[model samples]
Target: MWDLAGTLPLPLGVLDREGSTVIVGLNGLRLLRDGAWKRARAEAGA
Candidate 1:
């Protein structure tokens, strides 16, 4: 995730495991959401 943000030059704020305190760029959020969705779908299929 950090790597993705780095490549995209996305802004970020890390507070903890939860993202409630985090601030991210639109592209970053989209990428993160897509990654999470893919992971969840794979796990579900497994």
Candidate 2:
């Protein structure tokens, strides 16, 4: 997840492993919901 998040065009926010939550910033969340995560993973060949 961290690896995929790193590929995002915008900055992601605090990732809390203990809570198993990814607190993404507003823009990052929007992008992720818009399929940025998949695109990033594909682009990275992951």
Candidate 3:
């Protein structure tokens, strides 16, 4: 994967404003959970 440090982050409304209701509902939670899981796994591995 590339760093792309200069890349700008996408806004929350970047996705569907009406559609993807289910995805919108779970996206943030899933992202946070995955982040925590990744950190936990990385620390455990280290």
Candidate 4:
């Protein structure tokens, strides 16, 4: 098993009055085997 903990060195928030409800941040994931996982992508739309 493994665990990951990180901080977003910049500002990130979910504003309500500004008509925004999503904030993006970065995280690093490491596995015990040998592979690597980076840049988890996401999209928002109606």
Candidate 5:
């Protein structure tokens, strides 16, 4: 997740590479604002 200000990258949860799974709660996901996500994705060219 990213902060609403889009200046910091917040830790949303954990990822298990071997298991190919991500552990994130609903609240954590909600912490990410749409604008921040869109800005980040655009910057990353994703």
Candidate 6:
């Protein structure tokens, strides 16, 4: 999820099961949710 509101840029880091670290982005989530994320998020927010 998007954390720390307003302008500027946000940087984040995470580790996986194997201890492999990687970066995440909104575009990735968009593509991952291309099937139904939009409606789901709207409903959740509503």
Query: Taking the tens digit of each residue's C-alpha lDDT, what string does model 2 give over 1-46?
Result: 6556676333333334423444445445677574787887899996
Name model 4 segments beyond 4 Å from true: 1-4, 13-46
> Can you give the TM-score per candidate against the true fold?
0.32, 0.31, 0.30, 0.13, 0.30, 0.26
Regions of model 1 farther than 4 Å from truth: 1-32
Model 6 worst lDDT run, 10 consecutive residues: 13-22
lDDT of candidate 2? 0.56
**1-46 in candidate 3: lDDT tens per residue?**
1225634345534443445876777876775777788998999999
Whole-model lDDT, model 3 = 0.64
* lDDT score of residue 24 within candidate 6: 44
Candidate 6, superposed: residue stretches over 4 Å from native: 1-35
Off by over 4 Å in 2: 1-25
* Clash count, one per candidate: 0, 0, 0, 0, 0, 0
Whole-model Cα lDDT per candidate?
0.59, 0.56, 0.64, 0.28, 0.55, 0.50
Where does candidate 5 stray beyond 4 Å? 1-31
TM-score of 4: 0.13
For all predictions, the C-alpha RMSD in Å is 11.9, 14.6, 11.2, 17.4, 15.8, 12.2
Q: What lDDT tens digits, residue by residue, belong to model 6 across residues 1-46? A: 2333543333332233223322345445666765677888888999
* Residue 34 Cα positional deviation in candidate 6, in Å, after optimal superposition: 1.4
For candidate 5, the TM-score is: 0.30
